[model samples]
Target: MVLPPPSHSRPSGALARRAVLLGTAAWCVGATGCSGGAKSPAAGIAPAASAPRTPSAASSSASASPSAPGTPSASGPAASAGPGGALPRARPWQPGPGEIQPEVKVAAVRLVEALGTWSRGQGTDRAAADRAAALGIPEALAAQLAVRAGSLRPHADAAVVRVIDAQYGGILSDTASVLVVCDQPTLAGAAVRPGGTTVDVRLSRTSDGWEVTALHPAAPGPAEALGPMAREVLAQSRIELPPASVADIRSGAVHDSVLRAMLQLAGSHRMSISVVRSGHPLDVFGTDHPSDHPLGRAFDVWRIDGHAVVDPASSRTLISAFMRAAAAAGSYNVGGPIQLTGGATANQFFSDDTHHDHVHVGFTA
Candidate 1:
């Protein structure tokens, strides 16, 4: 089943613009609030869990394995000479003209930015709610967001969030799901720690636009001994994943075919995965055909060898090579930004706007 085209552009500075809009705009009104089918932001809330730690420099060598699942890595930015050393500021995310349902994705991204970011001396208790309310989100939703934000332990006086990718988990006429992948660098007195999370954001459609309804933060699933192959993939320094995807791997739901292919592809390039099984559409975006992702037989990679697949500046050669490699690793269906010819089958390789930002690899087995 074919979905829409990939339509994200490089982000620009828009924090000031957002602040102004948030000050004047209003999305919540009347007794109806935003939408009827909206799920409560507090429902199905997962425990606040930290992402799998980035491997330290010493363990990140091409030949070395990644640090264990929860191992702590180095801190974030070095403090500046000023009071708290200027902490990084998140540039508000905006969708490009080609994005599918741009407003929906924007609503999801903005909500996450509000929940994860804060200024110096701001108490975590109310900071998320206050920022969300300023963005025109309803009071009830903002308060729920505050409760979710309270579970986080930033260990810093200030924090900033940088969204790496925002992808549609599912999109329908009345509701939608967005997977918001981000990196947060926090600033303490002078010490900064690198942190981030992936959230499954739920939204419902309204005349104004899409209104955020719920937030599902990823949780590190209960510890269980994993197969050798699965354990190795989790420890591989070259393979990166969001917290939710990490949990998927740990949950023992992913098929072996997917894990093997990931290891096979990692042999050549460093990759960043955006979604696995847990935070994806059960069916293909627009069709009833079941998506390989929900079956644990597929995965999406957004960054290859450190180059974002969406960026026009990333080399075509690299992305193309990665796609081909997926086929070589036993993927029956391979989709990416570039449409390559000479695959084993006529439809083996595909290029579409919806897949413009990442490479999708699906296995039948």
Candidate 2:
């Protein structure tokens, strides 16, 4: 569904003041260590962010296995290795407690990691089935995944996938959809190039736990002439997006309201968008109401000015400022880690454990 462009209206004085208050609150919370503390993962490096130390019920349900021969475990000897030795294995990605149906999310992430990651010189042909077998996935499902994996072009000799974040696209008692946001750095000859994609993983609940049923990689749609505003956003250097999001904009599926807000925010900070429309939940997680995202009226930002919104070390002031600026840019609904007190209307500003890692800007029109 396409939405019409919105008017370019200036923010009210009250909203501007609210932005300041939000920033101040973030600063105080950061200084006092009131927020949960965790280190940000180093960018463009092998073995992305470390998984949370505390294990959830889901982690116990879906365990990790070697992606290929010679792969090391997280607790293996690489930890005590000398300068010329093997590096520590990348920790498996896990869902936080706040995530809805943590076990379901884990199942989806594991399958992606199995499919996307492999050892050097490992033949890509049978890797998907082999890795899926290692994870105890059923034979029929394994074959299906193999067909899907066969189409992926191997860009490098070796690859490691690091999940940026996993969010619920939709959830129900017997089914769920997980959007796994990740990036892969591939080793080719002596160089590493950055790459990744967002996947819409479908799952079904079983007596044991949630099991993956299918995988839907983002298809940004056909390339075509876009509106001037869309073209401008696509060319903006400060605004980073995944391939699918780039396609979403190019497809002209996203609303002008979202694009305008993005441009306004880019004027002040560099932002990395995780989802625009193609990879998001069609409905609010576990709800019947349609989400602004699938309607092309919303966008999710994972990073602002180089600091990850999920990182404890990231500046609260920056995130808060960005969130407020989004509202001022014409967003009727803005959500992030910080829950601001005053808003032009009820439910205009909100916070939830699920949103602790990114800011959501939503438009009505």
Candidate 3:
């Protein structure tokens, strides 16, 4: 559309001046009533400031004018709205014990937002058990463990094993990982109390899902190391690291090739070690477990490279040979049934559906 030239337009100053003059005249009316009989409409015209103003859509929707005797403005008494546009006259939300605030979703806690949001929930049926098995928090298992432990106090929902530090033991491909232990409050009003309660929790990742195979107290052996391992895995996997540092589960000090070496040396025949399911304590026992095992030096042996080794089925060649090597090395103690059935190893060991699929080995300095 064609527009008029800039020179033809009147300046804004003219309008502003008129508005000011009208305001001054309104003020003079209050100071002095007209000596003449009746006042003219133009004489008492309201000031621009006093006139009703159009409210912006972004601001309040109501328009405002001078207040009359005892009436409220058109904005209507300010009130808050509920789910719908209708205002809620009463009964606003009041937070109660164990009540999760609407605003405090997984995102609300900044530091643990990822842990809370991204962690896949264990199936509902097994949520408590799954949480226990997953090394969640003490209070988590406490709720259930309390049932078994025979107590009724609320306890920590999960225990956190955080990375305390990382130290490279200097190039023989050795590095030390440190971890700080804490607790996660899943259940409200739960406390771990002093001296701490124990639960066994296994950490396993499958192609389809991540599973905690076991949950129990910190045992004396390899399982004690699981907390450290869990912490390292949780941190290193999430952060950038040095090139020499290894990211694979096996590379870590926890799951070195010692297990393979132990099994291979014991078996006389060609033996392969395949992981049936690899996780922490949960894979080994329930949360009420009495003792912790393989904290730093234990592992469960499953198949010998896809070959079943449990039940009536016995592995020949490999079992005997692996035991001989272990006996020769004399670095640590080796137990289990590689020597039994004409094989050259000890059969003094424990077995279960958890360890049935594979053999678990632990390391000790």
Estimate the Cα RMSD of every predicted model relative to the unseen true structure.
9.5, 14.8, 35.9
Clashes of each: 6, 0, 77
Error of 1 at 103 (Å): 5.6
Please report, in order, the local distance difference test score of every candidate based on alpha carbons: 0.59, 0.56, 0.22
Q: Which run of 10 residues does model 1 get worst, by summed lDDT?
A: 28-37
Per-prediction TM-score = 0.65, 0.63, 0.26
Prediction 2 global C-alpha lDDT: 0.56
State the displacement of the C-alpha of residue 44, model 3, in Å, after optimal TM-score superposition: 84
Candidates 1 and 3 compared by TM-score, better number: 1
Query: TM-score of model 3 relative to the true fold?
Result: 0.26
User: TM-score rank, highest first?
Assistant: 1, 2, 3
Question: Measured by TM-score, how close is model 1 to the native structure?
Answer: 0.65
Candidate 3 residue lDDT tens string, 1-365 = 11111111221111111101112222122110000001101111112112111111110101111132111123322222222232211111111122111111111111111121111122132443333323332344323432221101113232221111111000000110000011111221233222111122122222322222212222111122234443443243222211111111223433434434343344433332221111122111211221112222333232233233332344545544443444443323333333223322333222222232223333334
Candidate with the larger TM-score of 2 and 3: 2
Off by over 4 Å in 1: 1-104, 118-127, 145-160, 170-176, 184-195, 203-207, 286-290, 340-347
